[model samples]
Target: MVVPLTVALGAGPAQAASCSATTGPYQKQVEQFLGRPVDGRQSSADCLAIQAFQRKHGITPTLGYAGPLTWQTMYTMYTQQWAGTTPNKAGKCPTNRGRIACVDLTRQLSWIQDGARLKYGPVPVRTGRNGAETRTGSKKIYWRNINHWSTLYNVSMPYAQFFDGGQAFHSVTKSMWNPPGSAGCVNMRPADAKAYWNLLRNGDDVHVYGRKPGT
Candidate 1:
């Protein structure tokens, strides 16, 4: 039972009018992320732009505050967008291993490649939190359960592809941008998880590297 989640964007004119003016801790980073002037101060334009981004990505308050979570989301978006075609340019994920899934925990992004050719994503993912970090290094997709129910956590882990013990690639109903991160599994958007299910199979190589921020 894969219950899909939908995120609505764009606030009403009334809501839009509530954009905050007070500068946030991450104001400068937010401005730079949004391509605004990196003045380290918040402006009306910066507020509106930040608010728009927040709304688009389902960030809370939607009040144009360039807070830490907002900045983190922006950073993730920036890295994912910047990855483009060459997500494996660093060659951290071995290209010699044909048809492998690459998880870059540092950037919270994942993708599938076939010996240097990009097959799937550079999509956003929520990995394990500080204590239960997603293990790095080489792994293999040992099993897949399309409609997996987690007995330990009592959650529906749709499109689960288990790579490491108790840690897998799965989709959650909640926003991937939320704080604190997942228990251990690499949590993906429902769509991306489904795509992974379709593209990957049991025994396919999985490679995870980099330390997720704060972990």
Candidate 2:
């Protein structure tokens, strides 16, 4: 059954000390809110801004990094809302058991969760477009090749975490927002893809749902 995740932004502690900052929605939002450069690269100056904001809001370390909690707090306040306000213990993940990566294509958001605990994401992702729309269903990551290549498209699909056939979670450019996305692949920025590479492994569950609006 397809379901939209109904997670409230502040339901959890928000910032876990070990969490790494993400780009797009998290980094970009934080940048605009702090008036920092929106080059999409997290810099030391950006960290300072984050830290300052965190301190002001009582987030520990003022670490200057936009962890999940910090991002959630900032995103909630800045946008005036989150994807959903109700606490969804299931998090729309396929498995109510082990580590699962949930991708909400409609909202361009992806997050990894270990049952009830969020491991990462709820960050922006670019999925397949129109004729190449990414298939939505539950699948296991059959393999992960950090330097995978697509002979069909002749393009690099780095940090490839494959689930259904050639469809994978791999790195793409910021311009992925443009026309003609990858050939059914779930695309992430280089850094985020790397992070996913580090966190996920073969046999992990991937639950993809919702439609990519323009596709």
Candidate 3:
């Protein structure tokens, strides 16, 4: 996800017309995050930059307002990028566990590891929200459904791999960056979920930890 350098340039009349003029509460933070002029103002350049980021990350509206959700998504991306190859630098996710899938709710990232070697990703994910939070501690992938339909929510959870109760590692049609989150499931992008399905199996160790920001 390389952010375009052209975002700093004027949005032109067409883009400027659609972009939001209202300075959002997170305006200054968003400006600073996007490397725009940090005057805490919503200029055409700022709006365009922010909007480009929103579009890239699947944040809705994309009207270029520097809202809280936009800021939160940006912060999550920053932390994940900073994590680099050492997502478990804090040693929260146990390395002793063989072939484990680790989900760090705090950074909204997930990955697969076999012993000490990294297998898959530290990819971005959407976990359970405030009330319907994804449970912490150790679990195991017990069931897998390639095309599972959630009777509870009346939606499709593709490449679903049940790890803890109703919560599973699955793919959702919506953006992972969408606000709130899943109903206790680990929501992933299509490609990531598919990879997880191929890489993981029933009875594999699944470790979930950390607290999602809003939760």
Candidate 1 — which residues are off by over 4 angstroms?
A: 1-21, 32-64
Candidate with top lDDT is 3
Q: Could you tell me how far off, in angstroms, the CA of residue 131 lies in candidate 3 after the best superposition?
A: 1.3
For TM-score, the strongest prediction is 3
Cα lDDT tens digits for candidate 1, 95-147: 99899999999888899999999999888899998899999989999999999
For model 2, the local distance difference test gives 0.70
TM-score list, all predictions: 0.79, 0.59, 0.83
Q: How many clashes show up per model?
A: 0, 5, 0
Q: What is the lDDT of residue 137 in candidate 1?
A: 87
Off by over 4 Å in 3: 1-22, 52-63
Between candidates 1 and 2, the one scoring higher on TM-score is: 1
* Consecutive 10-residue window with the lowest summed lDDT within model 2: 1-10
Candidate achieving higher TM-score, 1 or 3? 3
Instruction: Quantify all predictions' global Cα lDDT against the true fold.
Output: 0.85, 0.70, 0.87
Off by over 4 Å in 2: 1-81, 84-90
